[model samples]
Target: MFVLSSPSGTGKTTIARRLLAEDADIALSVSVTTRPMRPGEVEGRDYFFTDRAKFEAMVEAGEFLEWAEVFGNLYGTPKSYIKAGLKEGRDFLFDVDWQGTQQLHQRMETDVVRVFLLPPSIAELDRRLRGRGTDSAEVIAGRMARAQAEISHWDSYDYVAINDDMEQCFTRVKTILAAERLRRARQTGLVDFTRELMR
Candidate 1:
């Protein structure tokens, strides 16, 4: 399992997509949320959209691996989907926050590779947020404030990548994934295969 967490505009989703495109075994873990569908977001594809009451009910039922309220909406990863991915030996990519990462580590018998991405600088972050042209200046200011809080949790992650150069950052993330996949715990099947080859 891989937990890829970052502030709103740090390109975590882009890295996740690139990873899936490169690895045949990796599967992006689609999360369920109570947030309104953004334009072009499709049901059951981008996210499983639901109402706040229903989302709270899932929480009470212990159905989610982790849940967090963000920007007046709730987002969570369903526990069942993760279990199914593990059964299939699939690498699941979680584009969640640090809170979700902690929950997953406690509840699952999974090897989690956590990578937290940081913007090149506060100035660059501001530029990128404004570049979206979707949010007003007031909203952009709020996001910058929130981003500081988010990045403060950098120490909680296993690896940190500064996305100054997109291509370089992508390469670093890919390298991290390749190295993590070779961990002894993740390569149980490979151990036997290698032993047979040695014989």
Candidate 2:
């Protein structure tokens, strides 16, 4: 139920991993995509990489909760996995874009918590992208251009964290998680538990 979204080079994945490492209750939802694997990626860990045909078939089968085609690849979240996590009373993390967040909010409004991560500046975004050194100059330019469009949707999110300092950003996200987990709706059952104790 924790949907963490950020643009391509904002270090969302790194923050997610650190959060997962620190909290055993949080689990990351692996997205399935038609994009090819990067050098260090594993089959199911990074993404469930598949061909365009398979991705289209899954779409036809009504398997994805949300899907979007970006630049030339398709990315989607599997519906079954998210439901399973919620049923088991586990917190699931999503490293997704705003479009996916929209679909998720429509499907599970009360149970979802969304956070947006922003870079300190466009210059910093370029620096981070270049630091990765994975893509060509042309691809980085494409990502930078797309980032503006992506960031324009920040208002749709519940919380926004500027990634100026990693530790501060992590602390802010953690604070939001703690507060959201105690929201009145989420803690509805707590009243009954306490009443039973009093009785």
Best-performing candidate as measured by TM-score: 1
Writing each residue's lDDT as its tens digit, candidate 1 over 1-199 gives 8888888788887888888898888887888899899999998778899999999999999999888988798999898987887877788888877778888877873577888999999888888778658888898898888888888889988899999988899999988888988887887698789999999
Q: 84-186, model 2: which lDDT tens digit per residue?
A: 8778778888877889999989988888899999999988988877766888989888878888888989999999999898899999989999898878777
Q: Specify the poorest-scoring 10-residue window by lDDT in model 2.
A: 180-189
What local lDDT score does residue 110 receive in model 2, on the 0 to 100 scale?
81
Steric clashes per prediction = 0, 0
TM-score for each predicted model, relative to the true structure = 0.84, 0.82
* TM-score of decoy 2: 0.82
- For model 1, which pairs clash? none
- Clashing residue pairs in candidate 2 are none
User: Candidate 1: global Cα-lDDT?
Assistant: 0.86
